[model samples]
Target: MSLAIDFYDETNTITEEQLNMLLELVNHAAIEEGVDAGSELSIMFVDNDRITEINREYRGKDQATDVISFALDDEEEGEVPLNLGEEVPHLLGEIVISVQKITEQSLEYAHSFDRELGFLTVHGFLHLLGYDHMTEEDEVEMFGKQKVYLEQYGLTR
Candidate 1:
């Protein structure tokens, strides 16, 4: 599949190689979920303040979140091939991640920043693909899938 990923950040903490790895992980997850070719997704990295503002505006939460995803397609609609309907590409959705949270969680979890970031990236990507953790069973399934994806990418902590 051809994927277009855009990474935006207020600071240059994440290296180019790290971003590339994230893209690879997300794409791998997409393929596993049977996403068609020419899919596109965007990831934005920001500070705690920015993510907190977005969390408040979108989710009505006043706290900073590690990551948030906005998906364009509805999963219930079935696995239809994404059609751009024009020369434009199909926009899967956007994922916003808090780099500050990644740093903090890395320290708290006693893992490298790369692993934490990779986990967050895959978590957000799964959300975009219509996976959720609203119930215990759902949480188990979703988190299990996330672990599998991260492990496949060699991002185990």
Candidate 2:
């Protein structure tokens, strides 16, 4: 499968190794989740202020969040038309992460920065794949999946 990832580091604080690691993690996630071959997604790294603005604007929460995902194909089955016999990239939408939050959460949760970053990355990826933790049952399922992915990917706390 060909999964194109567009990465933007607005904070410019992430290292090359960290970026590459996340890219690999994302690719692994796509494979594990059976994503389409021609799928495309973007991951943007921002600061607390930027994420706060985004959270306020999009989610109506005036606080910085660890991650926010916008899925392009989140509409209902009948809402969006199907691609008929055409070879085109399926847009998976974007995952915006707060670099500052990563650091803070890692410390707060007593885990390595890599672990927290990987968790957030996979969490956002799951959202792009239409997973949500809205209800108790949904939260169990989604969080369980996240733990499994993180453990399998060796991003343990």
**What is the per-residue lDDT of model 2 for residues 19-62, given as tens digits with 9 covering 90 to 100?**
88888888888888999877999999999999999999999999
Q: What overall lDDT goes with each candidate model? A: 0.88, 0.91
Q: After superposition, how far is residue 50 of candidate 1 from its true place, in Å?
A: 0.4
True-structure RMSD, every candidate: 2.6, 1.3
lDDT of 1 by residue, 30-148 (tens): 88988866878889999999999999999999999899999977656567675757777767899999999999999999999999999999889888888899999989999999999
Q: Pick the candidate with the highest lDDT.
A: 2
Which pairs clash (backbone N, Cα, C closer than 3 Å) in model 1? none
- Cα displacement (angstroms), candidate 2, residue 51, comes to 0.5
Please report the candidate that would top TM-score against the real structure.
2
